[model samples]
Target: MSFESEESKKLGGIKLSTLTQRLAYAGIKEQKAALSRKATDNNIKQIQAAIMLQFGKLPAPAKIWANVRHKDFTRQVRNFMWKSIHSAHRIGTFWKHIPECEDRGICQFCNEPEDLEHIVLKCRRPGQKEIWALAKELWLKKHPSWPVLSLGSILGCGLTTFRNNNGQPLVGASRLYRILISESLFMIWKIRNNSVIKREGAAVPAHEIHNKWLYAINLRLNFDRALTNHAKFGKQNSIKTPLVLQTWSSTLMEEDKLPENWIRAPRVLVGTEQQSSHHPSPPPGRRGRNR
Candidate 1:
């Protein structure tokens, strides 16, 4: 309550700007450090348990966090994954304490309290189901069968490892999984927001979801292609050409017709089987349309 400490007052009183600045900075740093000392929340504990159950190995919290921020992930994806792990999204129980808005926590289709896990993995909603189906179809092109996925696996995808017959890391395949998981997860979230906030909870059409997913994957392909330009991104920063090719290898349309380096190939599309009957067959020599 007093403006002056005896020593400070002797020096220059409490009006001493330099001392005041130092004290304020130290208090801020101490408060910041206190955040790390707080106990982990149930959301994080659940994610850790899910990771162990799905992966058969548990990672430290720091490693999981680092994996979420992998450079392969786009900025929005990194943020999404981070928020997912922290359960920072204002859904489900976040609405429970609000008097009239508690209904917002309930899924219209599932009739269950809506949470990230339900939205991304278990929702019968149009977007979640269609997005995962498209992701699986594209993934099947690379592997014999898609790995069983859970919310934990999807969130910690960067930490997921793939190995070939010789036990060496399947770098391309692993990278591809991360990209697919992060992209698909973000798309699901965006569609849910659009449906709730823009459409007043109307379900997006399945065919539109399919087309949007196709565009998303093909756009990622284009991004990978652009990153392969060593001169544009610098040799150190650019993704390797072969790695990009391997990541997308069998998934593209007309794989047999493309040149050895299809990075610059035109009109590339992921060659998944179309789920919509009305979709036209791709023109000869051009597989997936990049819309």
Candidate 2:
């Protein structure tokens, strides 16, 4: 959509060049205003250059900033780029709002708040240290040039899914990276909540969080596996059955003798039988049965 709409003009003084540029500019202005400062001409110009670097050069800064203010950018840039530049400094401050996380006096996991850093970086949870270490190790193995070890860097790198050794995209690497980062964040969040809200003195076991992270990564990578194998793993893990399971289950039930409650119902039996059938049933009946 064009960023030069009448509504955008009314909200901000100028019309924008492109929707993306406008959106980026608007974000910077809004964040500056939210912090109780105006984006002066000089600051606006600098930000315009930054935006250009972030996204190619724009026709005009005023137009781009207007769009950014209106929040017209895509989610990827808005969440990752726009917010990263403006909100990164506030992360520690943001965590303070999490009740159990407020006191920086002691480590949340150890109840020693003495020198607690964010759970993602320096968690005191029982096995968290080991898991973080392993995550860092794995990340470095993929990105040896990365210098520091911090949750933000790890998360940022994972979200971007930086290129692999051969530069040919690693199949499912981006998804796997996201899964790893998400699992790590979730575990850290849970540990914080358990320590602060539940008053649990015990730290979250590192091995458990590591296993969870690994499971998430594996699941993302193996998403295209055969239904039978997926179901087998799902049942073993007690995870909910995916939609494919239901569709394949009814067809195969006649042939396969899988435990009735398997989460990822096997499709092998059903698919094989269907292949041998001379006449497949009507669509309506088949659809209803599958459902």
Candidate 2, 208-288: lDDT as tens digits = 555555554334323523433544666553323443343223323343467654444443221121112244323432222
TM-score of each: 0.79, 0.38
Candidate 2 TM-score, true structure as reference: 0.38
- Lowest summed lDDT window (length 10), candidate 1: 282-291
Clash pairs, model 1 backbone: none
Give the Cα-based TM-score of candidate 1 against the true structure: 0.79
- Judged by whole-model lDDT over C-alpha atoms, candidate 2 comes out at 0.42
Q: Write the per-residue lDDT of candidate 1 for residues 1-291, one digit (tens) a residue.
A: 887766765432334445667776776677645542342355456657767886577788888888888988999999888777767688896688689999989987789999988999898878987687678767777876677777777887888778888879888888888899889999999989888888888987776777777788878899889999998999777999899988988888888998988888887777864457476633443532232
RMSD of each: 9.2, 19.4
